[model samples]
Target: MTLDLDPLRSGLHHRHDRVLIAAVAGGDTAHRTYGAPEAADAEIGSVSKGLTGLLYQDAVDRGEVTPETTLGEALDRPEGAYAQATLGSLATHASGLPPQPPYGGPRTMLRRTWRMWRHGENPYGDSVDQLLDEAADVRLGKPRFVYSNLGFALLGAALARTAGTSYERLLLARVAEPLGMTGVSVPSTPRCLGPTALTGRSKGGRPHEPWTGEAIGPAGGVRATAADLAALLGGLIERRAPGISALDPAADAPGASRIGAAWLTTRTGDASVTWHNGRTGGFASWVGVDRDAGVGLALVSATAASLDRDGFAGLARLRAEADRC
Candidate 1:
């Protein structure tokens, strides 16, 4: 039942300067990191949203919240159209929220560009209170398949507020700790960066600042080692992970026909792969599983590039190999 990941790793190395690949097929597991330690931390970008989805489901299971729970109820906000959207809608990107709070106007765009080009700073960093303030006075679009970072940020805040804890602690208690993902974390600031944290780079090889902030943590601030993330994939595949129900499809998405919480399920060859990918200023990651086949793969890179196809290919290969076994 042992899996061969060399072919997949070789292909990934061709596309990325630094890459990490981990796989589990038929109860066998393997992981390899190139130009980085297997234990080094890397930004997981919007993959954090997938984790948030898990938190939402776990809250549902605990009777603290339900899919019908509105943002206004969880966040204690005043009645408004924007706050009327349910947590389920937010989890599935059908909440009609924008990708993020609007930072319109020429001056704001210029400042954001300056920070990114000059200092590699993340412009999305905001505190929970700040994000909540932005949610106020915002307009909602028709509920559809718009991917939203703001919706997730607000969802995380709502979940935390309902539990009477910070999102960081809630994530730890409800997901990371239970799953033994010690390397996974949502850092509030750059000062909390781990010593083993890997520095990511832009496509042009320019180093970028780590994406961190309490407000954005649920949306894109998660970081983890390859080993830890791979373990997470394994937990999900085994259905032992808390919030495992998050993988069940609840809406439609682009590319993937069905969306579950934050995971996307798409048919690749004969297998239905449930997966999520992430990207930050400099880092990219992809995690996928064919639950029926009990095979999973997680790939991370320090370079900012798409890894979706590579991840899907890797998982397929693992499933194929498992079939032979």
Candidate 2:
């Protein structure tokens, strides 16, 4: 069941796709469509959360923070009602924040968007700041996995304030530079294409304006190369990426069979390896390693989907084969 991935690369790139791979185990690095001499780059969508997670980890390493930290304790008041969450909650999608712009219509998109800008482009697209303006009222009543972009946005804001600097600077100073992840940043253009729908194909306006407006910047605003991700993955195995094993979850964090901090720990069934996969608009990617075998893999693609049974199987086989190296 070992997969070579060369044909996969050819199939993707030949179909006008862009692909990149860094086999940490074999020291094999290839950029099929975009390289230093070529022309293409990976468009990481929610994958950016991993980068944000890494920043938070660096904050922890500096003893400036902890996963148990509450947003209220981190940020000063006057922002107002949404606190009670933590870095772990935001990174793990358990912060109970909304998925997209709270409300919108295609007809109203432009007008409301302008309004959002006028409102300071808050990621919540509402008076979420006002909600958390006071620490006394904000509640940690209950917690659930809401896949919160808003929480990450707030966490990034918190990180910036704690470091006494901007979020972008925090990223470079604490993350990108340390990991040698050059050229990873917010994309100049939108992350994905407009979906084909009307009703409007989805709710909370997700599959629309993901990066539009200003507030959700911290949630999914990042792009990086497979090579850089591979190096970062190496840090996981070497335990240098923030000096914590990306494979190990914190005591209070829920146990996950797949990943810790934007990484997948194990693939089940016929696949007996570990990896982390990502899907962005017009792009799909995965990176993982056979922890037991000391072999690693990184992959990138242009097609995005959720239930890619075949894609996952293909990646497992590819990684398993590479794991032999």
Candidate 3:
């Protein structure tokens, strides 16, 4: 089906070299790809966390865990500040954890920054064991809304450990397959990135290395095609997705008035947009749903730049169409 996504395209501002837009209204879904094949995969960054949120809720339903379940219990880690944080707290970014693993010294920071700027190298390449080691000696502050890659990394590990599987395997079995997102994957190594993987670019158009890491898979390592993400959103809109309740606001979040797991619900006009955006050193993506209008929209760009504004604009356009229908 042909979709007039001109409003969405205009919002792009010609900043993206490769773009994909998809929207679903009522029972009709459409997707369009520019500068890339429909099956090409791009990093979805923190959108992985939003998907993990669904997994967390699904685990709860299966009695595999609870929101109150401590990371220590699931991961079998020793009692400590990091391990003691609840799964729910991590899901909602209320774990009092820092954004990423804290690295001391200016030298480390400068080196990391230089590598990213010069080589477009991935800053995250740690394994699950490495991530756990870093969390071991950490201290946590009072729980509040603080986006934490570290917290999500551990959350995914904990969930996997409790399920006697790896994070990628668990995701495939529980989330992707169920939602008809076969193209979605959390590649742990560069070799795992299939031929359909699209190389990402910086705003200035410099090529970037794909961000791949076992530990980061739960937080920001997801890659998917336009169709896969649209399917995910459609499943959520139809209340057929596992952990559909995760879309409901459960706690306060920054920017958005409330958050459900990793999804942020923000008031825009007469609708509430439950959404999450992702940015990596290479790619950017946004996915949102206007539940009241039964519309879901998603955009993926193979460039390390912002797509949130365009995504919202696209979603608003789709919602308007739905209203008219």
TM-score order of candidates, top first: 3, 1, 2
- As for model 2, its CA RMSD to the true structure in angstroms is 7.2
Clashing pairs in 1: none
Estimate the overall C-alpha local distance difference test score of candidate 3: 0.86
Ten residues in a row with the worst lDDT in model 3? 102-111
Write model 2 residue lDDT over 1-325, tens digit each, in one string: 2324466555343422345555544444343333222334454556566666777767877888887887767786434455567766766666666543334334233565464444323133223243233123433335665555556667777877789876666776666777776655553234332221111001112233323222344555555666566666576545566635434543333344544554445546645455445553345556555555455556654434331344455455555566665
For model 2, the stretches where C-alpha displacement exceeds 4 angstroms are: 1-5, 10-16, 27-31, 34-39, 101-141, 187-215, 250-259, 270-276, 305-311, 322-325
TM-score winner, 2 or 3: 3
lDDT of 3 by residue, 108-186 (tens): 5457658887989887777898778766877797899888988898999999999999999999999999999989889
Q: Put down candidate 1 lDDT per residue, 1-325, tens digits, no spaces.
A: 8666678878874548678778989998787777776678899888899899999999999999999999999988866446898999999999999887755554353586588777887776678887777668779999998999889988999999999999999999999988888888788888999888888887677899889889999999998887777778888999988889999987779975699889888987788888899988888999999999999999888988889889988888788788887
Highest TM-score against the true fold, candidate: 3
